[model samples]
Target: MSEASNPVVEGSLRERAARRLPSHTFSDLLVPVSSALDLAEGHAAGHAQRVTYIATSLGIALGLDAPTQLACNYAGLMHDIGVVPAGAGLGAYTRGDERMVFASLPLLSPEEAAVGASDSPEIVIERIVDHVIHGARTAREFGLPAETIKGISAHHEHWDGTGYPHGLKGEDIPILGRIICLADHIESMIDQAGPLLGRRNLPLWLNQLSGIEADPNLVSVLRDLASGDQFWLGLFSADLPGEISLGCSRLREPKGMRLLGFSESLSQLVDSRFSFTVGVSARVARYSEALGRAVSLPDLRLKQLRIAALLHDLGQVSVSERIMAKPGILSVEELEVLRNHPAYSRDVVAGIYGLEEVADWVAAHHERMDGRGYPDGRAGNEIPFEARILAVADAYVAMTSDRPHRPRADDADAQQRLRGAAGSQLDGDLVEIFLRQVVS
Candidate 1:
């Protein structure tokens, strides 16, 4: 598209500078355009877009100056840029994911990166939040402004003075940060549950939260909007695009391969992080990658799939080393624990960053095609392709490799079992693809 056709906000600040400002004026471009790009990690994937949207709304609502509004707009978009994802099984999820979206993405330069360089007091707090808080000092590595850093660092402080990391009381919170706290929480609750209260009395629900989790004034504003038909119409119009998300499939295949390698590394780390029954993790990692590639699955997808495959059996780690190491049949409790691991893995993975997108697949690896699977008993399309592939690979590897609980089944026996289970216990097409490769 031509320059005139471009949305003014869409282009890099540097590019926009050349067209709209004096050609050689470097002062206007405070930060490099590339750094801005680095500030958002896969922006389309999560709430960062909505957070920016609402923060803009809040800026307009507060009637801030153009410069401050523009700064807030960019800062809000990148506020959570320092989240360091350690994925489920070894970590947990929180409102922090919003912070990390901007915090953790690789930046263009260390010296001037938004997460770097702060010889100032304002930078001191920002440094504490982004790095010491998450284990990576992004604000120090990037030259983020003090005000911008302070706004993000304090976005979580409560109006009631009970907030974390710093017990800053109400009004003590920076205006921009307080507004962000307002916007972030409002968006979070709606996203977690439905925007509207479930079949209950609407006023009762909105009324209950007014003084509790939500700020009263903000709630009042929302209340007015919710009570009116025009607001409802506006909301309905906003959602007309149908919010089903789109993943970047253009490089998904290649990225999946890279992730496959990363998953192998991760799996190896996990295996080493705790005790393990055998050294079969390498084999598992390799074949999962092979299986994914064999099916024409992209590497990014395969990486997610490989993560599932690597960690799916981790719940078995909890089943008592004695039971896991025992050659005999397990007791009822042991069997129940074993049965629950598929779901347990999901919970474990959901807490970690970089792993949010893959948790369900890991959780659903044992689900049968006929919906007879454990955990949530999901089936068909509900069972992601990653789970399907991992299930087949797990079965193949488990059947052919000796487990502490059982001896290995031969290749022939494993093949027969897979073939027999197709369309019932296993995804038929996946099994077919797997066997075809193994046989040939």
Candidate 2:
């Protein structure tokens, strides 16, 4: 994973991000991509959403206008987008969760926490200081506004001048950055606290960071916002992402090709998290779209099919690499966890606006046509045709590509096995169509 940081765009990240309007809103693309980042840690599920809510609400409380508030909201959602892959990789080799180390390293002095004291100092420094830089770049790539990109780049800056990748102190830090810093830390505290207790101790949690960690002015705003029951209610609500989606205009634009590019970017990032799964999504996407065309699917349906193919395996990030790379057969328990990835993938995609249908197809990709699949037993027509196409594409890619347990399959052998499973394990007609396309 590259720990390189993007130089802050001179004018605005938001302007750069808005240069192109994709088929869907930026968040529609970003929320699912954020899922991959959120899943990088074992304990941080939904952390991005919660932080975004807190930051945006704080932005509102601070009397920022709706556009600036929306920018803050985008900043919150993607603040840590760059940290996950490298953080996950670092943690895998370190003694414990390196996320905590990365978060706290900025605050600690040289003797207290030597940055390079651990294994692989170069990579460690890159992970620590460059996340915000890379995050800004990602937002730029995703076409977010300049303010949003700057906020993402500066979210980790400390009030006391100790933060990394340019530690501007006090009021010098961008206001959006300051808001997100508070939101990001507060969310971490709430996560660290058990759910029931976290809500109860919100005041204490806010107080802990007032002076050194967060800007005191923003902390005051957060305190005011925290006083309202509606604030907490909204934060914990099942529809928080929906509520957030309604407020942000930048995330609502409909640009089909940009949305497709958004999915491709996310798939590449997700694929990078695993050593073996690189390029799997792209191949599946190509095959799935070709199969869709061969079957004479409409253009809109073809786009949805492609998006689903790109994101089909995002949930696997949550599964342990150990289990995924195991050379032998998995135990029943391990297998169960692995099989639940599609459900996870569905939840991730569904959280984004306008991708709910695509989420359904992603969830159904693992289902068997004969009612024998693991996650859901939907049989035959019960599975969406798009999903059936996805299943065949994913399965073929898996078989033909190298696996930890077996060498890549020859085309004839792969086709024979796929043919054997057609009616029962896959959709027979789709399989036939797909095979014909491949042969041609």
Candidate 3:
């Protein structure tokens, strides 16, 4: 049997992860996504909760057949499952999506790379707009219902019929799908305004969205829900179990974050202790944001891409200065070791459950679409969008940054080379965007 399918003995990694994370439930999914969205962008900070309320309210208004409403509620809360730091200020995943995708690769195993590579990246990316591409089937593996799958799958579709996959419209859209779509959009808008923001003028905003992208009927119910004095009072009310329980979440999430954080930190600690590597860890996080923004992406997505771009070099963090500073190309063995660093980076982050998404991209920093890249030589679609975006960032950062053997490339020259590598190694879209930023 392939190693990817093979079960390995769980030891340090699985043991600690199990100890920290909670058992899976429809509820556990809500917390992490809410937290990450808050971290990313806070426009409508309670996007999840509001989505829940709006969706269920619409469900009640339409008399959603049965279990479908339940599915809508659950799917709306946890739809953006793969995003890391799922919090406010995420900036609608503008730039750093590529970066986040980059960070996710290394987290995949050789087996995963093979699986990702098994399907052509072009084919997979084509499916990205459709429900089948991103997490539809994977969600099914987790045992979600057909309605939930349909709701989540079509969440990205628009009412004007301009959305991806099969463009269903108006009443043609599944009732659950329509409810989720409106709930997610309104909730995100609410997050931008504080709890009071929604109170001040949410009715106007709800009215504005009617028939544009959201279902008109669903929008009206949302207006009705907000028209009450109890809208914010009900959601933020002290008695609600979700918010009340989140009081101590900050301290709790770190336990998961640390699992991944330590992998990077551990290498630095080891390197510093042995005096092997050349750079510092804290220094990387603060500076990498600029490097990440060097490419064109949304501000929210850029934040993560920068961190991953900063940490993309983390594999080299613990290498000996001798090896790091070596003048010429290295022996085959040295190159092999260099490739393993991506896996090292991923292993570090994988310990943190929240970072599992990030780890997958980070672990494959060196992989290529042509199947020639290393650590695992995962080609094409085997790599994720975040990883693909990150691969470009890594190249951009490495080329521009000063290295032991070579001085940084001139800005003009570096930009040209970045554009040239698109598709062969880096994503053409990312390369084009990065160049535009440089030119701008």
Candidate 4:
């Protein structure tokens, strides 16, 4: 099927490309982005959603006010936002060693995994600290409330003061953090065991961890909630995303340029996974915006294009750092794995309410005018105009930036490549405008 005619590409360009598009609150956008983080961590699809639901439910049970409850929800969704950069620093470890480090740390008891331990232990501890600090900073950049920031920063802190990031004991940890900490662990447990088995063991597990890994009082609240079957059922429900949206319905939605800031922050997280690709998304967004304007795209279309550009590689998180950072050419198997990122990006973006069209554009950004591109091979007019412009912009930025396999191209050389690939690999018209209006 042609790209435009694909059943997945709903709404006309005129409707989807309106100047403002549909308004989406922070919850609407971040909920889907949270799934992308789940993919990065090798967790189940709804890990963040389940955590959010559990945390928000606990906050309500604890009688937290609306703002605090909202903070709990937001913290749950983004608690691990720092994991990408934290894992990025583990470049010295082989893929197996990296897995061992992450897998082993979780099994450590609070006292055994203290932050300043020697040798390999210290590396994991420091990375934990880096993760929380970076996550908190990203939350602040998104304009989330201070409570939400604190919750994200301190979620690892145990009640006994043994956690890596801060070692806060008892009531010292932010209440939101305590709630998220309990919820995060519980979700992980449930994920490891299916909900049915997880439900049977949850109470015993909570009692054991009380006053050690979790706040004892929060543990009591969770026990009370877990007594009812509905809690467990809702947690593992197929529609957990819907439940999360309902739970956070009260939080105020961020509007206007704030959305831009959120997208940029997410882009940074995606880029942080590899050293060579650090700011590639931001540059792609800029180039795409310039090309959009050059082609007289409406302001709304420009906004969508910029967001798609920023998030075009959201699926890159699913690729391992070992593969992404490989200095040599990839084998056929590795190349196939890398090529799936666009489809991954599309799935994540499509989950957001107002970004359906943006998702389609992102999916098609790698497509070729002559139908040689992947994930979908729509040629010529079958490709969305925005995707075509994005193709040229992405190509130009990628050519000019260093990659794992190649040094960056000089401007003249990069422009020549663009000229050579025009019509075959990229839209010819968009490529010319990019070279003249953007590069010049």
TM-score of 3: 0.42
lDDT of 3: 0.53
Best by lDDT: 4
Superposed model 1: Cα runs more than 4 Å off: 1-266, 269-276
Task: Kindly list the per-residue Cα lDDT of model 1 for residues 169-271, writing each as its tens digit.
Answer: 6667777667666666654445445545421244554465454433566556555545656543433344411221111111121111233333344344334
Report the number of backbone clashes for model 3.
Answer: 52
* Among all candidates shown, the one with the greatest TM-score: 4
Error of 3 at 127 (Å): 9.1
| Candidate 3 minimal-lDDT segment of 10 residues | 84-93
Alpha-carbon deviation at 133 in model 4, angstroms: 1.4
Q: Write the per-residue lDDT of candidate 3 for residues 1-440, one digit (tens) a residue.
A: 65545456445556555545333334444443343332222122354555666666667667665466557666666554323211111212223222222122222222332334333344323323322233455446445668877776777566777554567777777666677767766665655566777678677777676786678867777777677776667666644435422422422322223322323433233233122233443344433344356644456554455445445554443233334455688888767655666775665445333556766777776788787887788888898767786776567656767665678798788888877787888778767765675333
Better of 3 and 4 by lDDT: 4
Question: Model 4: residues >4 Å from true position, as ranges?
Answer: 1-18, 95-121, 251-257
- Residue range 1-440, candidate 2, lDDT tens digits: 22234344533664554443335666665655565567654546677888888987887777787667767877877887776455535544444445555545333532333243456556566666666787788778777889999898888788898786797899889989888888878877777776678778978877878878799888888788878788888888887766767767544434453777778887887777556688999999999999998998877788888989999998887776567766799999889989999998998888766678989999999999889995888989999889999999999989988877889999988898899999999999888887878644
The total number of steric clashes, by the backbone 3 Å criterion, in model 2 comes to 15
The residue-level lDDT of candidate 2 at 171 comes to 89
* Of 1 and 2, the candidate ranking higher by TM-score: 2
Query: Order of all candidates by lDDT, from best down to worst?
Result: 4, 2, 3, 1
